[model samples]
Target: MDGEPRTNPDVPRVDDVETWTHSGLQAFLQALFFVLIVRPFVLLFLGLRIRDRGRIPAGRRPFILIANHSSHLDTACLLNLFPIRRLRHLRPVAAADYFERNPFVSKLTRTLFHILPIDRTARRKDASGQTGADPRQRMLAALQAGQSLILFPEGTRGNANEVTRFRSGIAWLAQAMPEVPIVPIYLANLGRALPKGHFVPIPLFVEVRVGEPLLPRGDREEIRAALESAVKKLKDTP
Candidate 1:
């Protein structure tokens, strides 16, 4: 995975005609939910200590938000960074297997978070020997559609305050769309607030350190390593 990539013909390239914008009503409802419900809960309970927020790419310019995952709350916290109006186009990449398993929770997460669910199962060839749909294509489509994305490159949640090795999917995305900047964010104490199994969250403060955007500056391996390093550097920030 060290080299630059080739375009997948199976994946449709985003043209000016293809877009994924929300309707006026949809945007209104999203703002209502975030402001009336989510905002109060976060401020009153999960207090945030944010740093370098000014560095987040502004005004609908498509960008990738890469963060160290520790809990489900990670997505929620990251989503909070944007303004109410931007919530309509914001998408967080989530696991289809888990979030979509239950119909009720699936509806909740989809309508509220606007998650782009990816099938994390092993990609295999069918009886005809055609491979499965590449998850990266879906992410690439979203980016091309001009929607900002939230990605947990660790692939899954880990121990709180711990940065794990990132998979190369992000590298592939960076190479696929080098124009889109990748912003690194480090979140702390979310795992303890809402751990892997529990439901109710503990009132713990979360520290979010946002780093400067990184371009596709190197080969796939170097890009992945550079992403992991940026988040780790944020973790060690004062």
Candidate 2:
């Protein structure tokens, strides 16, 4: 069924909407200080470099920026390269299991960044028991609200800079929000800077190239293949 609503049995429904109330400015300031001030210093000290930042469009629109995930630093590196004015409208779709593991990270992700929780495991059924909270639905809702999202289609980080096969969720999202552009991003040298295990990033020059926006066409499988191919081409670029 197209545009059908699905509920995940595992996702606990909150009785009150107030439970999701956002944090105040003071709280945001404190969080921003750490994210903007301390984090950048560390990254800079590690000789982090970003290239092709001009490719990212500077405007307000419901869009999705898809990239290859390589390390924990992926999100931070993207945020660092993202335009400052556009930050407020962009939300990153993060894994619930990883981000929600700690209270502080969860609050920061939910309040400051407006991240949406995605279920990685396919076993959990949605409220209708048909499908879980499809990441595409969340992306559509964000788009309908005139907000943008950041997604890593590979699902997880790999060892090399090569692009992994994209999951079908991205295709589904593109199909649902045909008007929204899907921006492909390539972050070079991130894998070596900070691989999967290492918490601390070594001094390494990183390049982020934002390619042309992708519009959906054909079936879900076809779109998925296109998105994967686009990402691979972005990675291949010098």
Candidate 3:
């Protein structure tokens, strides 16, 4: 609770239990089964390599993980590299338009992993003419409910090593939930292994670097600048 409350606040409170129980036991079991039994083999077959994973924080506090987007592989790389203890509590903020389009994919995303639908184009009117929920509000609600979120502040994939301008939405979230730590992560060689528009990933050594958690200290711009700096440092490291 850092910033002023919104006029139409949809964010859940810090101690809200409804959000915590949204996904029931079936979801948890499915996620456990996939992560422990299925995902390891798939990652091994893909020749994925994760390094510098010790940087991931060990405690359980709501966190915002901001990373530079390079390819779809970024998600898998980060997921695999995260500490197993934290994996159960992590939720990736995926685009509503993309992942929710298909029923099977949507169910799998929600059940196998805690995937939240973030409307990137929240201001745009849907086919039915109703506006979508504010992305920042949705993200805040997730954080308030004691869940960690992974977001690509760039909004989409871009060239490897190229950090796009950090979006202001991340700044808003940081300010809104100052208690939650903002973690900076970097993925190396993912763009080369599976660049934009390529369906198949080339077998290559992938590297992941997790930087220190960032705390908000100043205004929105200052916090965003700090977050951007941390992410850039991870991207710059060899």
Candidate 4:
């Protein structure tokens, strides 16, 4: 979700998102942030719940977890959905322009979440007419290093009431990293709490529904369709 959603229009737009910070201290700080900030934030507002957690394999095995994107809360909600065993290795894929646009946000997103940045401004092809390297390469490398990812393939926040068609980049990533499985997630009512404009969240009771993992199918369109269907199936889950 091409980069992070414009949670508020007042934030600045910056250049590329950097990944040069990963230290033990950063990891510790991330843990604290999750507990001190993220945990309380979600608990106080969202009636967040995860379903079908058993479908996801246990241990440190890396898998791409894709979810519907509506508000900035989607990121936080997804992060809290996993158990402690998997949360340590899960990284959110955010848009560079939104999060990296300011010094404060860049530090928070990079140091705490260790997010993978996608160049939202990139053209479809480079000057030579060949496709440029995907932003998900960083995500793929993270997976190779035993880290999992939370991705929103709609590439942008959609209306909370409906899901948009997913971009095919997810399929390519799945094909390239076939060793990792793909998990589909459905988020409901997140957008109503904080859609595109409002900075202060409205304290809505959001729901998180996790689906079973799907092995990467090489066909991009087919994979996208299946993922969409899977997410739709969980959209109305209790």
Top-TM-score candidate index:
1
lDDT of 4 by residue, 19-64 (tens): 3435668878888888888888898867676677677766778888
Steric overlap count per candidate: 0, 5, 0, 3
lDDT of each: 0.80, 0.71, 0.72, 0.76
- The digit string of per-residue lDDT tens for model 3 on 1-238 reads 1233333333233344346333557466655756775466437756665555666666787787788899887776666656555566777888867877677777666666567777687645444456556777777877777778899988888897588888888999987887787889887788888899888877787777788777778888887788888888877877
All candidates: TM-score: 0.87, 0.81, 0.81, 0.84
Query: Ten-residue segment with the worst summed lDDT in candidate 2?
Result: 12-21
The residue-by-residue lDDT of candidate 1 on 47-106, one tens digit each, is 887988999988878999999998878888888888887886788988877887777776
Error of 3 at 138 (Å): 0.9
Instruction: Give the candidate number with the greatest lDDT.
Output: 1
Ranking by lDDT: 1, 4, 3, 2
Please provide, for model 2 over 1-238, each residue's C-alpha lDDT reduced to its tens digit, 9 standing for 90 to 100.
Answer: 3346544333433322233333466346535754776456646665556556666767776778899988877776676665455565667788977887767787667765556666675334454365555555655666676777889998888875578789888888888878888889887888888899888867777777788887879999999999888888888877
Q: Give the Å shift of residue 88 in candidate 1.
A: 1.5
N/CA/C clash count, model 4: 3
> Global lDDT for candidate 3?
0.72
Weakest ten-residue segment in model 1 by summed lDDT: 1-10
Q: lDDT score of model 2? A: 0.71
